[model samples]
Structures are given as C-alpha cells and as structure tokens.
Target: MTIRDVATRAGVSPATVSRVFSQPETVAPGTRQRVLTAAEELRYAPNPVARSLARRRTGNLGIVVPDIANSFSAMIIKAAQQEARHAEYALFVTASEELVDDEERQARALAPQVDGLLLTSPQASDACLRELADIVPVVVTNRLLDSVPAVLTESAQATGHAVEHLHALGHREVAYLAGPDGYSNQSRTSGLQAACARLGLEPVVLGPFPARFSSGVRAADLVLAAGVTAVVAFNDDIAAGLLTRFADRGVRVPEQISVVGHDDTALAEMVTPRLTTVHIPAAAAGATATQLLIRYVRGDDSGVRRYELPSELIVRGSTGPVTARST
Candidate 1:
C-alpha cells in the first residue's frame, strides 16, 4: 500500500515511518519494529525512483567491462552484483565489447543514470576516464590513473612469478604471446620484461594479438617458429587454444616445449594438459571496486588512490624442464 497506510496501522506518524525506512538509526527500536511490521502486513513498498529523486541519489550503481563474455569479466560481474545487492543498491551493467570508443560511450550514457561507476579493465585512456570521473564518482579496476581510485590485480608481479617458475624449470629462452594494448596488458608485459631481465633469460615477444582462442591457435605456429623452450600466453583461453593447436601439429607440451598462461581461469584446468598460470583474483577485485565506489558515493573522501590485490603462480602440467631439442 503506502507509507501513510503503514503509519496509520502502526499508530505512528508518516515522518516516523519514513525515518524508519530511510534513517532507521535515528528511529527508536520499538517504533522501528512497529513501522516495519505494519509495512510488512500492508505489503507496502517505497518507490525507489521517487526516493532517489527527492534525495538526489539514484540508489543505483553502474559497472562497465570490456568483454562481459570473457570468464574474467563474468567473475567480476557476478561478485560485483552480489556486493551491490548486499548494499541495497541496484546495479546497471554494460559491456563495451573491448572497444575503447564503446567504453567511452557507455560511461557517458551511464553517468546520468547511476550514482557512481565501476570500470573493470577499461580500455579507455587516462584522459577519458578522468573526464568521466568529473561527471560521476568512479572507481576503476585493472588500470591505474593519477586521480582515479583503482583496484588493481598484481598482474605484473604475478608475471614475474611465472617467469621465475619457468626459469627454475630450466627454460632459458621463452616466448610471450602478448595481448592487445591496455593497462592490464602493459602491466603484464612489464612484469615479463623485468622478470626476464632479472633471470638473465631472453624473451621472444609475439603479437599484440587478440586475446582470443583463435589468436592462440595462430600463436601456436609462431611459438614453434620462434623455437623457444617455453611460452607464456596472455590468458588461459589462449593457452588452451595453443594446447589444441600444438596437439594438431604433433608438438607435445612439457615434453618438447612448456607453456604458461595468465588469469588462471577455469579453462586452465579443462584442457588436456592443465595450464600453468598466474592467478588473478577476479572476484575479489570486483568486490573491492564496488565497495570503493559505494564509499565514494557516500562522500567518504579518503585519500586512497589504489588498492592492489595479490596474485600467485600455479604450476600445472603444461610447464616442465627444458628438453635437449628445446635447448
């Protein structure tokens, strides 16, 4: 029914009913319980849109991802949705399909409709992200900008761990199947480079390839052509693709050449030779980013700029010691 109906049934004023729903902490416990019971009995539900308009808040949050179809993005979305529900805020999610132009458009469109925005692995440039933040509160993930608060996975550090693991396995020469240009890719590539340098190993950097399974299939030939003892792929999907391609070409993984991948997605284990990978905490990153955005929406202006999550390297069947021919 309505707040008035509930107030009448509860023998309380309309203001008290409103306070019980919106500012419950200010309402007395007995009065709060009475209002809640009456509202439940009357099946009364407040109009969120009207409340938002009056309060100058939408009670809605927005999240934008590069590719919602990707497993990594899917995990983030799932976790973020749960967090938003727990906070009693509605989530409006959009996928930019890995296009920077689409990402910018979505950000602009979502800004007016949402209280704040959560950008996960955004492909948009630093300038565009900052401008969007000017329109609404923004918290980003997988990207670090000067002013924008970000929840970043330690992709770079994890890559270093992957490199060390390969090194320990006696892989002197390795290849990196690179992904498309973005903050995440940049961080990963930097980590690979640093690790290679520290370990006194040489790296054969391959394409700014599409981070897709098909791309991994094509990279299989390139990996063989480069003749490295091991290869690290952009993600598990690509590594799985490589496994299929290598099998087709009669190249045995871990026997002839070892392989590793990033973002230890489920695909890492489903393949014939389980993929060794860097575990990026996709769920944790999503939850943390939502929490940060909510904090900003509530006007908690803490000076925290970045939140970096830890990642680890998981050694699996896909990687092994260098063989005689590989060396």
Candidate 2:
C-alpha cells in the first residue's frame, strides 16, 4: 500500500510519515510510533524518488567496493551502514568485483542519488579518483592517493606486526601471500619485507593473488615448494584458502606450516583451526570515512588528512613455534 493510505488510517499526514523516516525526532514520539505501527499493518512504503526530490537529497551515502563478498569489504559496509544511521543518512553499498570499469560505473550510478561516497580499496587511478571527487564528496579507505582523503590505512604497520609476530614464534623464514600488484598491496609487501629485514628473518614473496580463495590454493603449492614454515596472507580469505588447501594436501596447520592472515574476518574464526591474523578495523574505517566525508561536505577546511588505525596480532591455533624438523 501507499504512504497516503497508511496516513489516513493513522490520522497523520503523509509528510509526518516522510519525516518519521527521514528525520524522526521532528515528530512526536507517540505519533511516530503510531504511524510506524499503522504503516507496518498496512505494508505501506513511501516513494524514494519523490522523497529525494523533496529533500534535495537521496538522504543516502554511496559506498563502492572491489568485492562485497570479501570479508574486509563486507565488514566495512556493515560499519558504514551503522555510521550512516548514526548520522541520519541512508547508505547504498555497491560492489565493483575488483574491476576498475565496474567501480567507475558504480560510482557514477551512485553519485546522483547520494550526498557523498565512501570507497574501499578503490581501483580507480589517481586522475580518475580526482575527477570522481569533483562530482561528489569521496572518502577512500585502505588505498592511498596523493590528492584524495584516506582513512584506516594500515598496510605498512600491520604487515610489520605480522612479520614480528611470526618472528616471535621462532619462524626465521616466512612467505607472504601477496595480492595483485597495486598501491595498497605493494605497500603491504614492502612493509613485510622491511619487517623481515629488521627481525633478521628471510621473507619469501609469493603469488600476487587475485585477492580470492582460489588464489590461496595456488599459493599453497608455492609455500610447499619454498619450504617456508609460515605464510602471511594478504587477507583472511587467502589465509583460509591456504589452510583448507593445506588440509586437503594432508599438511597440518601449525604442525607443519603455520599460517597468518590479515583482516581477522569472520571466516578466520569459523575455520576448524582458527586463523592467527592481524585484526584490521575495517568497520572502524568505514565509520571514520563517513565522518570525514561528512566533515568535508560540511566545508570543514580540515587539511588533507590520513588516519592509520591500529591493528593487532591475534594469536590463534593456526600459528605456533616453527617445527624443529622444518628448521
């Protein structure tokens, strides 16, 4: 049914229902509750386009991610939604599936309807990102660009922590499952290498995986061949994949080859042997990016700012002291 139908039943005007959805505090709490109950009973809903036109805003924020299926991105979306709700805004999340073209198209589709955009692991080039920012307020998370604002980037720091954790476990040799060669992943690789040198450990760089589970399978062979005692995966999916592949190959985790993943995704804990990983705050990143974008939208002359949230090394069953036999 329509909003007007529910309005008639609730004895309130259509505007009251609209305000109840968009700006609830403006309506009396009792009246608001009555309208909501009436609308639910009648299954009434308002037209988004009409509401958007009237408000001069879609009352929404756009979020573009390389892949929504990826736990990191999924967590960020959850956080962005919560943050948006706290800010009295709605969120429209989109997945680009790790394609530059798809990301650009999604951004275009979302720009007209939303007040601003929050991008995670953005695939677009700096020039393209600059252009996109001109169209709307854009706050990027995970990836860094010279001209754009970024939040929750922990490539160097987190990678270093992972290496140090493995080192503490008596792993003098570790393999890093690299992601596709991009600014973000490259930074991570570089950081891990630096940490390796500092810890006096040998670092082996493996496949620049497509940041997917299948890539983890491919990486397992490389790890087996290199004879590294531990593997630091670029993300939780790759780490989980490596763990699964290792199991399929009859290689035991922490018994033979220890594994560590980044992102501390839900899958990390759900696995049989809970993954040892770096806990990156993807949700916090989403929330902070929303705050920053809103600040920029409100003309906060905040200088181009960068925030690097803290990441922790989670000691779990997947990682243990290097087997003396491997050494």
Candidate 3:
C-alpha cells in the first residue's frame, strides 16, 4: 500500500521507484517493468498530490468549455476524459458559462494546476488566448488560430454540401439562425455564404443569436418574416428550438420550411421530426486534442500545429422539397 514497501519488494531504492512513477521514460525498460509489477503486486499507488508536489507535474489536464450543459460540450468532455485516462492522466473540467471575462479568469486559474490545458470552443479572443498559452501547454478544439495549436472539425466543405442539398430541394431563399459572434460563428457563416454564392441561392442572414434554445425560439418569427423557404441553424440547440417553435405555430417542416443544423447532437434525433444536420466528429476532436496536449507536455512534438476532423451532412426528417406554401 506504500511506495516504500513496493520499492523494498522490488529490490530497488525508493528514489528509483519514485522516478519510475513520475518519469518512467528516464528509467530503464526492464527496471520500469519491475517497479510496476511490484507496485501492482503490493496494490501500491503513488499519491497524486504528493507526487505532483515533488515533481512539479500534476499528471492532470485541465479543460474549459463555454456551456457545460450543452450536449456537444458533454460529448467532447467525455471523450477527453477517456483519452486522458488512457495516458495515465486525469482530467479537471470547468465551464465558463459563455462569458468572456469568466472564461479568461477560469482558464488562467486552471493553467497552473495542471500539466496542460485543453480549450473547447473558447469564447476569448485570440490575443488573450495566446497569452494563456505562453503560460502553459494548450490544445484548443472547435476553433482555429495560427498562434495557438488547435484541433477542429472542418465544416466548410460539408456545410457547402448542405447548402447544395437545400438548393436541390427547390429552396431558393434560406435564412441562417446564427450563433453569438466567435470563431465558430465566423467559420460556419463564411462557409454557408460561399456555398450560397456558388449555387446562386439568395442567403438571408437572420441573427447573431446566442447558442441557446431560447434564442432559436425567439428567432422563429424572424425566420418566418424573412419568408425564406429553408433555414440553417448554427447548431442543434438552436435547431431544436426552431423545431419547437415551428410545431407550436403549426408550421409544417419541409413543407413550409426546411431546417438544417450543424453538430449532429443527440437533440438532432430527440426532437419531433428529427433534424437534418452536418455530423461533426466531436469525440474524435476531443481525443485528438487530449492526445496532442499530453504529448506536448511530455516534450514530444508530433509536429501537428493544427488538426481538422471530417464532417458529413446527415439527411434526416426535418428537410424536404419546398411546398407551394413556401412559395
């Protein structure tokens, strides 16, 4: 139960046992194996806090998300936790509640306590994030910046495909139910714009709405007023909200209006008339970010400054050919 007992049983000095636990790469392969075997036999485990205090490496990774309750963030965190555990590390997570000042404060505070940090869909500006990176090893997911290492889903191509799909369904005019201004909003918006231009479809920009269900509900009237035949929401949260509002108003989806969403979250399926959305690889992005940060913390550069996962447009029940009512 004690490291000292395990060290004695392994026929190795206590210092060597400590080194094996903290910096196994520094120990010989056979010696490391012996120490591990002895520890396993004795049911011995190094105390995380004590070991961290001695070695200055907490063996922990910190992650910050904008909304902890959001399904996308939940999936990413779960994946990050699994990947961290696989590397013999643990995860500490906190939410920023979508406030810029709170995000920066929480991230800065969490930096010193962990070996590295993973930021998911950060709300802070790039310059501020760069300052944080200067203090600790950081891996960012769902956003991209040249100054900071990042992993994100490359949504532009698939978003373009979604636009094409809408256009093919005879939806000439489409409104975008937007999210709050951030790198993610910029990316999704630009991708959609470029696609509309290529297809010669009229694109109406409807909102700079929050990434919340309420925003989607409020935006429904605006979307209806725009008189567009179809709508592309920023994410599933907004899309689901739109669904609820449309149902309450007796607006038949796909007949009166077709709706498309991004980040194919569980809500995509749970809503009445399942959402047609672009499938973002949230779990893959999370795992990759965790792996990259842990490697960076180990002083190993895998040479990946940025990583992008693929996406696809998943056609579902929410979209269809435009009806005469839309016209």
**Index of the highest-TM-score prediction:** 3
Number of residue pairs clashing in candidate 2, backbone atoms closer than 3 angstroms, sequence gap of 3 or more or interchain: 0
Pairs clashing within candidate 2: none
* Candidate 1 lDDT (Cα, 0 to 1): 0.89
1-327 per-residue lDDT for model 2 (tens digits): 887888898999988988887788899999999999998999877677776676676678899988888888888889888888887888988898888888888898888778888888887887878988888888898777867888955667777887887888788879988886666687678889899888887788877788888889878988999989989999989998898889999998898888988888899999869998888888888888888887776678466578888777788999888776656
Task: Assess every candidate by TM-score.
Answer: 0.87, 0.81, 0.89
Each prediction's Cα RMSD? Answer: 3.3, 6.1, 3.0
The TM-score, computed over Cα atoms with residue i paired to residue i, of candidate 1 is 0.87
Query: 1 or 2: which has the higher TM-score?
Result: 1
> Which runs in model 1 stand beyond 4 Å of their true positions?
3-43, 325-327
Per-residue C-alpha lDDT of model 1 across residues 156-273, encoded as one tens digit per residue: 9889989999999888889999987877789889999999999998899998887778889989998999878899998887888899999999999889999998888888888988
Candidate 2 vs. truth: CA RMSD?
6.1
- What lDDT score is found at residue 27 in candidate 2? 96
Instruction: List the candidate 2 regions with Cα displacement exceeding 4 Å.
Output: 1-51, 301-304
